[model samples]
Target: MSKIDPKDIQKRMDRISEIFSDIVSHAETVSKTRCPYRNRHDHCTAEFRCRNQQAAETEEAPLVCGHEGEFDYRSAWESNPLLHARATKKLDEIGKAAAKRRADARRKKTD
Candidate 1:
């Protein structure tokens, strides 16, 4: 039997390594974008990158920070008390505007 060429073998091995690296990189990118916490615009509204996703771990996996499960965006925002306050204030304003519109419609119906 003829012997294999060392150069050909090395080239094949290098190609295999490159293909595997590309596959891994692609998987990582896909995984990071698959979480439901990601918004419709594909942005992490919590304003921080997910460490679990970067590590290729499931969202429910235990993290060194003692946090578990998917990144809770609501909790993240709530952690900043000012964010909740601002959201509540905005909701109040919207409710008032809606009530005013309903009252205006009733007055028009009576007239």
Candidate 2:
């Protein structure tokens, strides 16, 4: 018969929303960086050279590069304050939700 606190639910929903928003925004940046490794124009100049311009184009994963880039979201997220904040917030929200769910289940079993 305990009423769920509106403020608490709002906080949970807000946390989830922020995480999802950040994930989406960062994902877009990752995608933008996924251009063809080898273009006639030769746009990319990262440490990991894009030699995939010939008949066969093979590009290494961004993680292979020492620098943070669009392909390497983990690195990007780490370096970018906004991205880092978003990722951290998202993780905290997930953890909180999981813990809350566990406690709710326990309460239901006991009830």
Candidate 3:
């Protein structure tokens, strides 16, 4: 079994962190409303719930998840100029690995 390199993992982790920080900062600046996912009588149907429950309940507009309430980071990320390119590049690295793994599984089944 081939192990993913620690350095590679660390790089990806750093990139992800940068993206997360950018998103949080952007939300804080642009968002005047509370998080929509907090303290609802209705189910928190959104993919990601707001960590700020009090803000969600009281604020008219909540800082919603990037993926239209889905837990994805791409939506907010794409808009950010500071970290978008690097984040997507890191994501591509992961995608390539996943593709390789899938191909390997197919090869094993055939053999």
Deviation (Å) of 78 in candidate 1: 14
What residue runs in model 3 are displaced by over 4 Å at the alpha carbon?
33-111
**TM agreement with the true structure for every prediction:** 0.33, 0.33, 0.29
Q: Over the stretch 1-111, how does candidate 2's per-residue lDDT look in tens digits? A: 999999999999999999999999986875665543323354433323233222214465222323234353233332434565687789999999999999999999999
lDDT of 3 by residue, 1-111 (tens): 999999999999999999999999988864434333323443332333334222334456554332334343333332334365677789999999999999999999999
Which stretch of 10 consecutive residues in model 1 shows the poorest summed lDDT? Answer: 61-70
Q: Which of candidates 1 and 2 reaches a greater lDDT?
A: 1
C-alpha RMSD for every candidate? 13.9, 22.7, 21.7
Q: By lDDT, who's the top model here?
A: 1
lDDT for each residue of candidate 1 in 1-111, tens digit (9 for 90 to 100): 999999999999999999999999987775553544454444343433344323215665333232243454344332454566687889999999999999999999999
lDDT of each: 0.60, 0.56, 0.56
List the candidate 1 regions with Cα displacement exceeding 4 Å: 36-111
- Candidate 1: RMSD over Cα atoms? 13.9
lDDT of model number 3: 0.56
* Model 2 bad stretches (over 4 Å): 35-111
Ranking by TM-score: 2, 1, 3
